[model samples]
Each structure stands twice: as structure tokens, then as C-alpha cells.
Target: MNNGYFGFCGTPTRANSQNLAEKLSCLHLDAFARKRAEKFGLDIVTTSWEDNARSKNSCWGPCITDMSLGVKEDKPHPRDFLMSMIRKPNYRDETCDTPIEKFCVTVGNEKKNSSLKRITLKEFLQDIALYTDNNVKPMWRDRDSQIVTSVQA
Candidate 1:
């Protein structure tokens, strides 16, 4: 998600729905998140970063049509399985940013059976960027981003 500011924050979790939505919305506004979301079958278009005040100017693109995994029969990835299953499947539109004071109270209520946890959009995008740039290998293993932590002695 990057948020165009902080570096890697962390993966999304189930607790921070509003923050996650904000991050997603910000990322959607950028070129990088749009490209990655399309490739991964994520439903990014429905989200609106702006609340009612800015809804008229918000952008709406194609909705995510494919939520299936890359593997045949939509097999779940190892990491995906380890994360929250019920909450993991849930996704938020980036454009849904209504201030609590002005908007309805029930808008961002927490869910009981979500499969994924809420993570900062920056972390989410970082994860996707890492995979896209390095063929899914962690940054530590990437030739360009790898750091020399070992001592010769």
C-alpha cells in the first residue's frame, strides 16, 4: 500500500479496518497499486477514499472479477492459509472514507468472521511490490536489495 510516504509498515490485520481502508484508498489513487490489484484479482474499484463530501469526484474503475489463486482450482497460498481465513477474504473499497462524526456510525463496524487481518496499505503494497519486482522472493534474497549483514571475521 506504500501510502506514498512511509516505507514498509506491516501486513494488514483484522483489527484496523478503517486504517486499512484508508491505506487501500491511498494506494488505489496511485499507479502502482492499481496495476498490482488488477493482476491479483483484488476488488479495488468499488472503494472510495473520499466520504460523502467528495464522493462526486471519486473514481470508479473495473471491479475485481477474479479472486482465485494463481494455481489451478484456486488453491490457497501457504501464507494465505496461515493468515486469518475468515477475515482474509474481506476487502474494502479505497474511496470509503467518511468521517465518523458526519457519517453513519454503523459504516465501519467490525466483523466477527473475517478471514484476514487489517494491515497498513503501505505494507500490503510493499508485499505486492516485493513479489512483483523480485519474482516473489523476500527482499533479503533479492540481489539488488539484499544487505551485507555478515562479518568477514
Candidate 2:
């Protein structure tokens, strides 16, 4: 949680009677964390992932979505098997101004890439300002100011 700057950062899903980490983030946690970060003179990001998962009590979104290869299902595209099963997220709000703290992408396929597919992924990242003005800003830039530090490994 931003190196102790945050206290109760969590993911989209809450546990069904689970540990503190599984507990959904609430006002108490946020206020405490905010106060602590401020007391430390830190401007760290402190937000939890919204519960975009469709099921109310599922342990994992994928388990609820239950996407499968569907080997026997008549599929139009190779990716369609994975895509058609999961519920797409609707941010509840219509605007695109939500600030992104981090971006993580995990792909199961490790085989050769198609030129068309590769270009699409490249375009997607570029559209999100992931390159950060050609490296002017590093990722997860969640600070009030930028301080370039030199560390010896």
C-alpha cells in the first residue's frame, strides 16, 4: 500500500467473511490512511479497485466469469472463446477521466504474435499515455511532485 503510505488498499472483489485484506475498503480505512500519509508529508495514492466483478460473493472474478476455451463451441475468432464468457466492466460512470494508478496486463498466450494483433496492443498502450511523453514520466506516477533519486544497488 505505497510503502505504508496507505493502509487498506484492496482489489475489486471482497471476501465472503474474509481477512482484513479481503474486507472492502471503507471510509474509516481511507481517512486513517489519508491522515497517516499526510502526517508523513507524503502524497501517495490511496484508492481501492472498484468491485467490478459481477458476482456478489465470488472469491475471484474469473471464477465468477468462468471463461473457458469452449473447445466444442463454434467460435469465429481464436480470442472469442475467452472474450465471450467474461462480463465486461462498465465503470458506472460515463466519463473517461478516472485517474489510472497502475496498469497490469497478463496474457496466457506465449506463442508467436500476429502483426495485426500486435499493432492493436501497441495502439492500446499508446492511447493510454503509457509511454509517458516518451519517458518523461515513470509509471504509476502517484506523487505530488517529481524527485529524481539515485540509488546504488
Candidate 3:
């Protein structure tokens, strides 16, 4: 399954870019993505990034490695990541956003079974928890708590 990065909606200035990174970091994206995938009954086969060679190189050691799957420190470029997913035949675009809002999209066959609904951050996290309880091993208890706390704050 492919996952899009956050904060890819517009041309960001330097300050805006930093703000985006901070937001992404606070979101704990890797954990959130894993939970979302599980909620949709999808197993993560692998993860990848789409970026120019320079960006890829810079991200390689810390960001794109297998071990970095849920690492909080690995901030990814959302626009590049989302564009990469858009190119894939298996993914379907489910949501759109303007420069001021964040973007959301769906991957895999999940779209075939359900209508595309707007996914809120809270709902996404709840879905993740549901998926963890029903389909997979119970591993996200702490992560869910963290997400809830983060969201509340």
C-alpha cells in the first residue's frame, strides 16, 4: 500500500515549510499511517518514496529505510510523496484540498467496497484502533493513546 505525506498542498515558503515539518512531526505520521492501513484491512507490503536523487539521498540513511517506518524524526516531503502515489495504477484519488488545507487520498481496493468519505484525523485514528483490535495483533494501544493525547492538545 502507498501512503501520502502530509503538508503537500501548496508552494510553501521557508517558514511555512518549517511549520509543515513541525506539524507532520507532531502528527506522528508513521504510526498514524500504519493504524490507518490496518483500519482499512490492508497489510503494508512495503513502503517507498518518490523524490529526486538528491532528496532521496539525503533522506536515505534516516528517513526512507525499512527501520525508519514509524520513526518520528524522519520528516518526508509530502508533495513528492503524494505525487508518487498518484502515478501508481493501484491507487485512487479520494480527496482534494486547496493551498490552505491538508490533502487525503485512499490506496488499494478499499475504495471499491466503500464510498469515499472525508476522513478526519480523529476518525482516522479511531479506524486505526478498530483495525488493530479486529484484524491484527493488539499492538497499537499505546500509540492510540498517544494519538488521542496529541489530538486533544
Candidate 4:
């Protein structure tokens, strides 16, 4: 999943600033990640955002929703394998802050017997590659697209 920037800076005029919102509205990192996941034959299950501080029960920042691989039937209990991605931005005003991109995989119920690991997007994809017997390399492109590199494992 991808996350949207709060806003943009360095605009010369009001008109430019207004246009920035429109141009950037569709440019989200989660969307790109979703595309990469789909390219690898993973099925998306759901997309939702996390609540911010102002919202009720707002502990986590805004984040994209959960996705599933649809491989539950192979398991005895029919538990769905799920994944979630979060793109965290680093605000310039926040000293020493760095951007964070993380992906988490869950094999069973989130509340029980689930193997959840939060790792870098690259590491997560590498794990996916190992799991699926496919060598996966995700390349960043402009907001419009992504380049996926895959080799049979």
C-alpha cells in the first residue's frame, strides 16, 4: 500500500500551489506498491487508511489497508495470508526524521498464531520471492509506474 503526502512546498505562486494538490493527489506510494504486488500475481483484498491523532482511537498514522494472497484454502483452518504496507513520510520540520516504508505479513489471525514481521519493502519483497520461488526486484519509477524484476527461483 501507499501513502499520500500531506502537502507540497517550494511553489512560486498560488496557482502553482493549487495545481500541486491536483497533480499530487493521484501520486501515492501505496498505489505503486499495489501495482507491484499485482504484477507478481498477488490478489488484493482490501484497502483502508489508519486514523490520525485527531480521529478516534488514533494511535497510528494514516496507512493503506490489508491485502491477501488468497491461499487460505490450502491450510487446514482456511486462514487467509495477509499483508499490509505503510509509507511514512519524513517532514522537513522534524529534525532527524527519516522516511519509513514498511511491509508486514500475517499468516493467520492477527490476534492469534500469526507470524507478523515488519520489514523494509525490499526485504518483504525478497521474502515473497523466496516464498513463491520467484526472484523479485522492485524498482522505483515516477509516480506513474514501477518496474518489477522477477526471476524464477
lDDT of each: 0.32, 0.31, 0.34, 0.35
Ten contiguous residues with the weakest lDDT in model 4: 89-98
lDDT score, candidate 2: 0.31
Q: What tens-digit string does per-residue lDDT give for candidate 2 at 113-133?
A: 623223223233434354234
How many clashing residue pairs are found in candidate 2?
Answer: 0
Please give the distance, in angstroms, between residue 45's alpha carbon in candidate 4 and its true position after superposition.
9.7
Residue-level lDDT for 108 in candidate 4: 28
Give lDDT tens digits, candidate 3, residues 80-134.
1211111111122122223211323342335447555565343444455442335
What TM-score, over all chains together, does every model reach? Answer: 0.19, 0.20, 0.23, 0.20
What's the lDDT of the predicted structure labeled candidate 4?
Answer: 0.35
After TM-score superposition, the amount by which residue 148's alpha carbon in candidate 3 deviates from its true location, in angstroms, is: 20
Q: What is the lDDT of candidate 1?
A: 0.32
Local accuracy of candidate 1 as per-residue lDDT tens digits, 1-153: 566432235565676444332443344355664555456545233211222222333444333222221212233323221111111112332333332223211211233453445543334334544324344633222232321121100
- What value does the lDDT take at residue 5 in candidate 3? 40
C-alpha lDDT of residue 149 in model 4 = 21
